[model samples]
Target: MTTPAHVAIIMDGNGRWAKARGLPRLAGHRAGVEALRQSVKTASRLGIEWLTVYAFSSENWSRPPSEVSDLLGLLKLFIRRDLAELHRSGVRVRVIGERDDLQPDIRLLLEEAESLTAGNGALNLVIAFNYGGRDEIVRAMRKIAADVEAGRTSSASITPQTVSEALDTNGIPDPDLVIRTSGEMRLSNFLLWQAAYSELIFLPCLWPDFTPEQFEEALRQFSVRERRFGGRNERDVVSSSA
Candidate 1:
């Protein structure tokens, strides 16, 4: 079977999903977590090497205090509950974002989870919590500038590869497929630099209701497409099944 080396998702419409059922927003968020668990299992079974999810954006801080607290609480619970199982299943967990804003306890848990699963080889699961693409780019640039100032590298050597190496996803491959639930067409500032040529699949299902079948459909669709990567002809594709 054809499998994407990496897949990224923008899990959206949780608020709407909750409202439609007369449930609180946090209820939908909780359901989203269950969906995420299923997605991880399905992706691993399907042989996907890497998966990234936009769990919380930098802009999410504007939400009400109660909601923010609930989200953070859920994150803590997730780490505590899933770390052992993930490690056992050979899934490596990594959080990519500005983690200084997180609570100290939460930070500690995240660090521990990462360390525990660092040697896993089944799948690399990246959760973008409090993450922003623009902020990531700026952070990368700042690191590069500091290195250059320290005479570690010359300005002429500051290529795209150099910038990519400084980013949080330094050792990870760029996503081959980007799926956004709730039918959103925009990137919403997620993986701006890395998703330049990714195959985008906009799903109509809300994040809480996303299913493995839907994910399989996305993969099947991706398998049929001829990825030219900006080239005009299908000949550029190394393998085209359809």
Candidate 2:
């Protein structure tokens, strides 16, 4: 089975999932963690090279204080409890987003996770916390501007590659498949710049309900479609599958 080299997911509807069950909102976030773990194992089994998930967004902080606290608490526990298992499983962990304002302990946890898994080669797992696509682009532009000001780079010589290297996902390949759960069609500022040509899959299942079977279905859907970057396809002469 030929799978896309990189896959990105916007895990949504955790709160809704809990509300539907008459459980507390935190109950939903906790269940979402389980879904995330299952996803990692499933993706690794399917031979996916890169898996990126939107764990938290820059806009998420605007939520209620208690909810934000619970989310961060879950993040802390995930790293503290699951980091060792991830290292043993050969998953390279990368956290993308701003960190300067993060709690000192959380910053250390992220750094520790990255350092421990830096040499692993199995599957790359990226957690986008406090990340926004537009913010990422602006951040990249600021970096490029600084380089140009320092006379290290010329503005006229800049290219797409130059800007890409400055973004939070500098070392990561752009996602070939971007999946948004809970039937959300919008990107929600997840990867605006990098998803220029990604094949998108929107599943109706909530994040907590996303299972391996659903994942396989998405991949199977991807396998049959022909990916032609913008230009006309040769198969168009007889038939087209888009």
Candidate 3:
């Protein structure tokens, strides 16, 4: 099978998963963290170069304060408990999102995780915390606008590549495949600019229940699909003539 170089996942359905089991939502979030750990291992073992997970979104702040706090707490625990193991396993951690107004402690932890795993090479693990695709694009535009105002670069000279470089995921390659669990069919504001041409797979399993087998099945589906990226293959030409 053709394995994707980079795979991004929108982890969803934690609250529903918990409700289904008659457990608190926090329980489901905890299980989702475990699923994330397993996914990292699976991706690395499968020789996938990069894996990005949508952990938290900017709009998630609108949730109840208690739930938001719980989610942030879980993020802290995941970093503290798993950072060493992640680094030891050769996973370089990268966080892409807005962090200017985050609490000092949370910001420090995120920086620490990235710094500690900066040299690892087995897999690139990107955590999208406080991220929103449209927000990212707006930020990039602001940067470009600032540069133009400062006479650093002309507006006319700016290209798609320039806009891409201004985004939070500057050096990272675009995802080849995007997977959303709990059967969501939308991007949900995840990696908008980067995943423009990415193949999408939706799995019915909740984020907490995502397994390696299901991930492999998504890969299998991707392998059989042809990606022309807006172009047509020879098969299309033959069919049109016949």
The regions of model 1 sitting more than 4 angstroms off are 234-242
Q: Each model's TM-score?
A: 0.95, 0.96, 0.98
RMSD of 2: 2.3
Scanning candidate 1 in windows of ten residues, the lowest lDDT window is 233-242
Candidate 3, residues 1-242, lDDT tens digits: the string is: 99999999999999999999999999999999999999999999989999999999999999999999999999999999999999999999999999998999999999999999999999999999999999999999999999999999998999999999999999999999999999879999999999999999999999999999888889999899899989999999999999
lDDT of 2 by residue, 6-80 (tens): 999999989999999999999999999999999999999999999999999999999999999999999999999
Which residue runs of candidate 3 sit more than 4 Å off their true CA positions? 240-242
The alpha-carbon deviation from the true structure for residue 114 of candidate 3, after best TM-score superposition, in angstroms, is: 0.5
lDDT of 1 by residue, 40-115 (tens): 9999999999999998899999999999998888888888898898999999998898888788897898899899
Cα deviation of 1, candidate 1, in Å: 4.2
Which residue pairs overlap in candidate 3's backbone? none
Give candidate 3's TM-score: 0.98
* Candidates, ranked, TM-score: 3, 2, 1
Model 3 scores worst on lDDT over the 10 consecutive residues at 210-219
In order of listing, the candidates' clash counts read 0, 0, 0
Q: Model 1: which residue pairs collide?
A: none
